[model samples]
Target chain A: GESVGLHLPTLSVQEGDNSIINCAYSNSASDYFIWYKQESGKGPQFIIDIRSNMDKRQGQRVTVLLNKTVKHLSLQIAATQPGDSAVYFCAGRPNSGGYQKVTFGTGTKLQVIP
Target chain B: DAGITQSPRYKITETGRQVTLMCHQTWSHSYMFWYRQDLGHGLRLIYYSAAADITDKGEVPDGYVVSRSKTENFPLTLESATRSQTSVYFCASSSLAGGLHEQFFGPGTRLTVL
Candidate 1:
């Protein structure tokens, strides 16, 4: 089945540096996209989300970019801090009549070096 | 005060045994979801509920049963557990107010079936 996937399994960045995580999704019918962060022993925490109607959305020090033509999505974190180190996952929700189904990517581990 | 929680942070069960994982949320979200996270699979939805008494199967729902008897509780039961069922399970909740929105996740439960 076609699903969402990440480009890299792990990424390392120096503190205060910018970090970028990439994701690819196969479902064009998807209308909603979300990014989540998971610490070592916790559930995924919601970071930011973007809708297919827009190409980009920004939150506190975080930005999400969506490219419908390539079926790609990316998350950028500015001034990466040690506390920002975690596993990041991208989820896509396909538009199915009334209710939508969400699919998650494998995830990318972000390591911030202080 | 208002958050989602799961019981039995860790469990070890034998194959063919019956086990149930419990999820609770203080917020009265209209939608609740169950997802399993495996090594390579990331996170896959097992089941979801729009409201009390309304449940639906997801990507990998086989061998898993879910019920939302109450708005704040959603439980997942494995009638006959298998070694392959050993994985981390997470419970999430969201309000379906605006089509689809960000989901709040609970601390996962690690289940090891031997």
Candidate 2:
């Protein structure tokens, strides 16, 4: 069973500071990865994604880094804010899937301290 | 209204009762997915549809059934709800345009089976 796992279950960071969340995946056949932000009582929202062909991708104030050699993925958020407090999930999509099935990590709860 | 939406934002039922969660997307993206979110399990895919009348099971498809009569609707039915089935369910839609496969998720439906 290929799985995506997170190193920490919860992360605390101060406002205006950068936040880094890490994820590890077991599926080397995964072709792409996505990061999702899920607030309490809401569904997960797409944050950023990177294809396996690329090592890193940036968007807005966020960056996604993928290390295929180490089977690691990370998300960095700049200037963490109160609104950014939420559970972040990392998902991997295998290239062999037919319907774009994705495997999601348990998630890391990001807590921003004011 | 232009994105995905789930009905009965919250639901409660007793064990052995049958329940259905509705998912509709306006994008007609050609791909829809149903997932259940638990405390430590994250989002586990239950079922997915590639197009109208085309469907397949995902990672955790047990105790659940799905149908795709049309492109916009993909419903998940629990034949006999159990206490373990209590969790938040999310519906997402994605397109293969640009080969990104980035999914857009609906708000979510919270179900509690006692």
Candidate 3:
């Protein structure tokens, strides 16, 4: 079965430092990848997304890097803050039926320490 | 003001009971999706709709049914709620396109089956 997986289930980051979360996908045809943030008891929020054509995309303080060759994806957060503490998930979407249907990976919990 | 929302932030039900989770989006996107989040599994798509009156099953669709009679609403019903069905449910929506499209999620509904 084609699925997405993460390298770390939990990550502890210090305030003002940087954080990186990694994900590996099994579907080689996945053309789109995204990173999401979910706070306790809340929904997964869209952080950033990177297309297979591009290697990286940047948002406010987050960046998503996609490596189609290796079927890997990563999320990088700059100057981590306590508010940035949440569960991060990487999702992959394939071009199917004129709509890109996405599948999610097991989440990586991010804990920021002040 | 424009975002996704889920009803009944928390639900408590018994096994064999019927439960319906609601997801509403203000963006009026063309695609709406239902997903479940558990402890280790990040999120598994239960169903998705490309438009009103057109829905398709996702990775995990058993024991669940969805309907999209309107563009802004997508509801998921668990015919017979079970202990295994006790998980956080999320609603997401996206525009019609293949790559570079990101899914925005709603606050999840935590369902507990006893």
Q: Which candidate is the best by TM-score?
A: 1
Candidate 1 residue lDDT tens string, A48-67: 99989999999999999999
lDDT of 1 by residue, B30-104 (tens): 999999999988698899899999999887999999998899999999999999999999999988673434678
What candidate 2 gets wrong by more than 4 Å, as runs, is B96-101
Q: Which candidate achieves the best DockQ against the true structure?
A: 1
Worst lDDT 10-window in candidate 1 chain B: B95-104
RMSD of each: 1.6, 1.7, 2.3
User: Could you tell me which residue pairs clash in candidate 2?
Assistant: none
Docking class of 3: medium
Model 3 chain B worst lDDT run, 10 consecutive residues: B95-104
Where does candidate 2 chain A have its weakest 10-residue lDDT segment?
Answer: A95-104
Candidate 3 fraction of reference contacts recovered: 0.71
Native contacts retained, all candidates in order: 0.67, 0.64, 0.71
Indicate the residue-level lDDT of B44 in model 3: 80
Model 3, residue A70: distance off in Å is 3.3
Ranking by DockQ: 1, 2, 3
Candidate 3: C-alpha lDDT? 0.86
Q: How good is the docking of model 1, by CAPRI class?
A: medium
Q: Tens digit of lDDT per residue, candidate 2, span B1-114?
A: 568999979999999999999999998788889989998886988898888998988888999999999899999999999999999999989884624337788999999999
